[model samples]
Target: MTATFFQRLGAVVILLWLAVGLAACSNFVKGGDNRHNIPLSGGVIQGLRNMGSSPGQGMVVRIFKEESVLEVWKATGAGAYRLFKTYEICAYSGDLGPKFKEGDRQSPEGFYTITPGLMNPRSNYYLAFNTGFPNKFDRVHGRTGSDLMVHGDCSSRGCYAMTDAGIAEIYALAREAFKGGNTSFQLQIFPFRMTTANLAKHATSPHLDFWKDIKEGYDYFEMTRTPPVWDVCEKQYIFNPAGSAPLNAAGPCPATVSNPALTAKLQADEADLANKAEAARVAAEKKAAEEAALKERGAAVNNFFSGIGSGIGGIFGGQGRPEAQTGTTTTLPTPSTQRP
Candidate 1:
């Protein structure tokens, strides 16, 4: 059978991942630590160590909901990022894609910090990274939630999960970030990991309004590597400093308007996801039927084979032959006398 389009797209992602891993291998050879526990996730990883990134130095995490990918980057110098690594986040509870309100159990979408002392050394999983959500920013906005973390596990209603091996590398990086004092850095979560192309594609999403707020935060990262300031009190996105970008604006920024082309692209992508869901369902049903049929066929085949073997042995003439006597006397005395 021909490969489904979604499967092909998944293949492309795998290839891109391979390329990214190759690129990052160079970085690891030069500056990254090799002693840290490596995770099954193949993304490149590095520790900050005691080496501090200057006040201006920081990192950005972009989580893609559709792909379940988290791309991490660190500021190389002024405005450039050294693409450090990418992680596969396994969030299965499809319902919790977007954060709706407090206690939603949904992975949050917005600005957060990587606070100090955020490490969970005793995690049931292999390792974890503490994403300081609902920090001062979240609480000020009345977005109450807790224990937001990225860790390993095949299961979760709304957390970023990974295999045990995947978490080891992440843990090492988190430790490095902590020791490097990059723990006070910023984190930006979106409904899906945002890309300019992806944003344009998802432009008309039913969740666009919520995404709009997210975009504003994303724009800040695009412009500055830092996470944007969120005014929880006003319940609006603050782009410039607290005093600069007022909540009430006289007019709209030209670039703030939604782009139709981008929206169309995102719509097309969503359509593809729907297709994938359908195909997966059908494939599952087909597999179940095949397994049931195989079980019945196997029983019949085994019975036939056994019967055939027994019939063949019976026909071979050994069954009707007389058995040898267990016992007694032989006439070897006459032969012995002749020999003597």
Candidate 2:
């Protein structure tokens, strides 16, 4: 049961190749999840859908603070979402958990959508992703929070904040949503409190009702792993299995958000982010180049002065004459006895 010499050599070579392949794989996977530059966009891409110039298609967004992730998913057809992409929220508020009502100063838990599109375009902040809150669900379930958005306010009062660069990518995803027919999308902003560990930690709060609703939403997400539809007027969540109830006399439960003016505002906000990003990038590069040149010039000046010093020292010390120096040098004689 002895193998031929050639056969053994082939086996050894194959083993070496396999080892090399595995090492390469290990290295490649080192930054596996983090390595993806993820295009300046977020979520899964489906070519079946196209983004039109207007934002009217149904958009669904999920914010998992626990994961520090915000994903944009676009509804292509019935029961189908082409995930636009995911973005990292650089900073979050208070505890890493869902917001409960007004003044909690925490990011709200449960489903909500953008109401008015108005944004301070001239904001000194990087950029804002305004999620119209207090939609039917928040009001009905009696949750509260307003002016909630994903913005460049790196420090958040109640909104999710990302860095200027992070918001730039988010702006793109939001714009794409509008263009792809997503006039409005749900924004589910929860703290990192959705974990089983987290739920157990806050299990005994007097505000347990609020947390209970959030947990329901979170569990629905865990089971079906889907965003809930905001039952506009009811101000509560009509879980998918529960089905949507008939609208009351209040002009449709989830008041249809027909704010064209708001849509325009969102578009403007997005444009502003794109412009600022480009400008900042250009300025940074210019500054870097200028700094480099200054360093080089400074070095050249130091070398020139050093050479002059050497020439002068040489003259008085019986070294090479100044004129024999390879680099340029100048000398000035000491003033003769001042005025005679």
lDDT of each: 0.59, 0.58
Instruction: State the RMSD for candidate 1.
Output: 22.8
Against the true structure, whose TM-score is highest?
A: 1
- Residue-level lDDT of model 2, residues 100-169, one tens digit each, is 6788888765666652263323334556756666555555555687777677758788878877776665
* Model 2 residue 262 distance off true place after TM-score fit, in angstroms: 35
Which portions of model 2 show Cα errors greater than 4 Å? 1-59, 74-79, 82-84, 96-104, 115-122, 137-146, 193-197, 221-226, 232-236, 241-340
lDDT of 2 at 335: 78
Q: In lDDT terms, how accurate is model 2?
A: 0.58
Give the per-residue lDDT of model 1 (tens digit) for 1-340.
Answer: 3579889999999999999998777554234444343432322322332222332356666766677777676666455554566788766334424554556768776666666567665555545667776654455455666666777776765577777666666565555555665646566667665554555555546765556556656655654555555543344454443354433332333223344544565566556655654666577789999999999999999999999999887766554543323244444544354544
Clashes of each: 12, 28
Model 2 quality (TM-score): 0.47
Candidate with best lDDT: 1
Per-candidate RMSD vs. true structure?
22.8, 25.5
TM-score of each candidate? 0.50, 0.47
